[model samples]
Target chain A: MERLAFELESAGPPAPRAPPVVVGVVASGNLEVLVEPGDLAGRCRVEVATSANGFAEIWDAVLRDFAARNAVAGLALSVNDAGATPAVVSLRLDQAVEEYLGQRP
Target chain B: MTPGNPGHLPARRSYREATARRRLAGILDPGSFTELLGPSERVTSPHLAGLGLAVAFDDGVVVGRGLLGGRVVLAASQEGGFMGGAVGEVHGAKLVGLLRRAERERPAGVLLLLDSGGVRLQEANAGLVAVSEIMRALLGARAAGVPVVGLIGGGWGCFGGMGIVARCCDALAMSEEGRLGISGPDVIEATKGVEELDAADRALVWRTYGGKHRYLLGEADLLVEDDLAAFRDAAAALLASPRSLDEGALAREHERLARRLADFGGCTDAADVWRAAAVPDPDRLPLLDADAFRRAVAAARGEEP
Candidate 1:
């Protein structure tokens, strides 16, 4: 098992009041994302726990891209990955954010 | 689309291969099922992430309400593809909540599409406690006169605590491929040695705890085909004639279970039990068709065949 954490500052303002959201299942080739309100000062904190090790750079790249594209400030995002590809990881992150904002994706 | 409405129906698929959501859709009336804690709710487990295991939004169990043959019913289906459909804290709690809801709402019946390998090994203690809670909830639902029907035909058959849970239901529906046992063959072989129970002998394992054997032993109420339609029809029939959970039925069940335990307490081989039940040529029983096996068991029991 591998545990990784990351923090990134977003250019946009903090997200509005929103409830926490979870998306996806933790099965082979799949992952689940949990997004909740955080006390970060215009920055998003991300933590990932994965069964497959040696994927720190991949996770960092994915989270960095996600933070740049989404206004995730003041939000905490966690992921439970089970050897999922980068594409699936990105999709679930977007889904978690969309669900947290109470919007259909 | 709601569960029961007929606007859209999924392509015909085998129940054994269908996902948990697909199974629920097939059982309920089209457009009638309204999930209580849907995936959108995102009520995931708080424990698995720490262990570095994957977590699911719905905790691997899908619980909701739907109309089965025009009667309101509470339904739950386990996702066999997720961690072998094992019951964890959140998954078990969902089931407990559904059963408790049945007690209060008093739906036509409670339908459980069980595909669990029992408690989750990762969260062993929590899973065991949750199963116990589910048992208590089942008893409560029974006391409230709510029928609980379990269907076991998914990739993983009911085992561990769930095997007993299925037996506690008012009725159980099973496919020929389904198995109902407390301990799996692997566990038994590991603990008692391969000589005691060969784990690799699939035929022997099936003969011991498979649907046909359980049906013959009067454990499973209905034995149908592997198709979803067969299961739906059986469920409809069961819900139509809800069994009363009165003292008489309780006493009968108690006596039946006690007699069963006492009758086969010392028997190691399934064939011996069959022979004691007066099943002629007990060795050939496993090869019989479902209908034929039912008739044979009834004839052996001196019931109308």
Candidate 2:
């Protein structure tokens, strides 16, 4: 999970407009996330700070998978967690991105 | 047959079962409770179990509608046995929804049997948002002439944002075994040293944070025994009573809370407050039970208990 203070980066076309950057609590034993459009167009860099450490590799792997599957670029993803596992985190992150993109005009 | 006794102890189970049992037996009549998203409905929190936490079908709070003294009532009760009666997303959602239903019905009133530590730290954001929604719903019900009676008699009592939520209610009732405070002894102990709050000092802590103390300080409207029947009766009576708060009364209540913070400025012990409130022999508080505590305090003030 990510802390209140988190940042991310991406490469390619800058977001044409400011995308919805939603951040907040997920649930107990759950995770909260923030996904916003960024300046990069082709690359996505994810940052995670979690209460449960020693799981950073899993977090990176989840992000890698999410990036590989989605055309989501120039976007930032951040998470805050109490004890949310990597898979659940990935799912929520994807959901947030999906929800935000759906809201795009 | 003895009065105030259900004559048989209710069946026991996990937090979910206890919640169902309590909700079923709490209202004015048997067979009156209609659960919103009960166990058979399977509205458990996907957010909790996804993270490997034991998730109950009801999440943590039981929400439903029933009859109380011939008037319709919607109520919510927390399950302290589960996750410290913590508030998760669905738990908070169910609560907000129940309050919404109460406002919609606007029949008798809404009752909340709260025993939560507030904002499930796991689902922090969702829980926080849900609490605000519940508060808004409560305010709506109040505007519609529905009184919101909060019962703070669970083992966990209330804390954090939930504590604030309970305070926002029109009135509150409690029992000796229950507590009502913003933070737990451990949290205080962690923030301050043991010397500051002394989590181990049960007597001091109880007098300072217990239901009896809050009742004396006027935080709780009713103080009764811990038996479930007592609570049920109190809820019935409160639901029928004229709602004492409206838009203006509520706005002024906030002022009273702020005054509490100011008047209680930097006090180290409850004994100080006892002396400040001018109770006789504030030092003699630890020896009193519920009845004795009430009697001693009242007598100290030259009044009948």
Candidate 3:
């Protein structure tokens, strides 16, 4: 497995009231994301432990895009991935954030 | 939106297809579920990190307290998506903790939404030991007058150690999609070859281990439709009638087992066992729905249909 960590500057507001939330499951071609409150000084952090190795660049791009699109400040997103595609990772990230914000679709 | 209050639930969905967390919500009262040792706690499997496998935050089993029809209850839902909901060191520890809590707290009942394929092969010995501890804890809870009920309705089904664990519960409510057996069809086919048991034949596999056959054979206590409300209702009703685990109960169970073996031990297929049970047309069982099959079995047993 490959462990990847990233800390990015957030463009959206910090989540102080939102509760921690988890989404998805760590299955083949799938992943689970846990979103918790973090004291990152208005920044977002992401940690990925994936069984499918050698995709650091793809994860980097996906997380960067997620940070830019979502209000993820003061939040730490941990992902347990099992060969999930970039799309699935992004979707789980969005889902975790939405659940954390007490919003459901 | 509280316990005993009817709230807006999702439209009818198959219990077998819902996620572990979703199953918990569907089973318990709306807005009364509070997850313990949840994914946020990050109490993941310690052994999976070294093996380079994905480790779930809640260790594939979600355990917590909730209200089931106005009564407080401790519950656990095994996530089949993660490692086939296999029992590892941490996963089994969570379940053990819940059962033990039930013994101490004496909640309404311990609801186990079992969907495992058994012990996690990745954890190997540790997983086996965890399952053993779980069995001990579960039986302990039962002995303490805390009813332990199980529901088996998932794509993976309950097999291996979990199957044994399911039988240890006071009662089991299974959906038509649920299956219960010690050795799974694929495992049997792999070990004894396709000639012994063809795993590819879905019909044969279901007939041998599915809910309908198990209920007919007296393995599953109640057989219901695949709907979530059906499972919830079944569990609620089962909680109202907790079976005893005293000496008398054990002796009766032993006698029943002995009688079953003596009468159907020579039978190789489930149809043969059903025939022995006096089901006039065993072949028609699989084709009938849960309600229809129940009626047919009742009719064959000379009960009011």
Candidate closest to the true structure, highest lDDT: 3
For TM-score, the strongest prediction is 3
lDDT of 2 by residue, A4-96 (tens): 332233333444444444333434566555566664556654555466656656766677677666656777665546677667777788787
Model 3 lDDT, full chain set: 0.90
Provide the clash count, candidate 2.
13
Model 2: share of native contacts present? Answer: 0.00
- Give the candidate order by descending lDDT: 3, 1, 2
Candidate lDDT values, in order: 0.86, 0.70, 0.90
DockQ of each: 0.34, 0.02, 0.87
Residue A88's lDDT within candidate 3 is 85
Off by over 4 Å in 2: A1-105, B1-20, B23-27, B242-266, B298-305
- lDDT by residue (tens digit), candidate 1, A56-90: 99889988998999999999887777899999998
lDDT score for residue B304 of model 1? 81
Residue lDDT tens for model 1, B1-305: 45787677545468898878788888899878888897657687777866756677788999999999898999999988789899999999999999999999999999999998999999899999999999999989988988889999887889999988998888898887889999999999999999999989989888888888888778888887778888999898776666677889889988988999998877888888998888888999877866777788888988886
Report the poorest 10 consecutive residues by lDDT, candidate 3 chain B: B1-10
Please report how far candidate 1 places residue B238 from its true position, in Å.
1.4
Per-model TM-score on C-alpha atoms? 0.76, 0.66, 0.94
TM-score result, candidate 1: 0.76
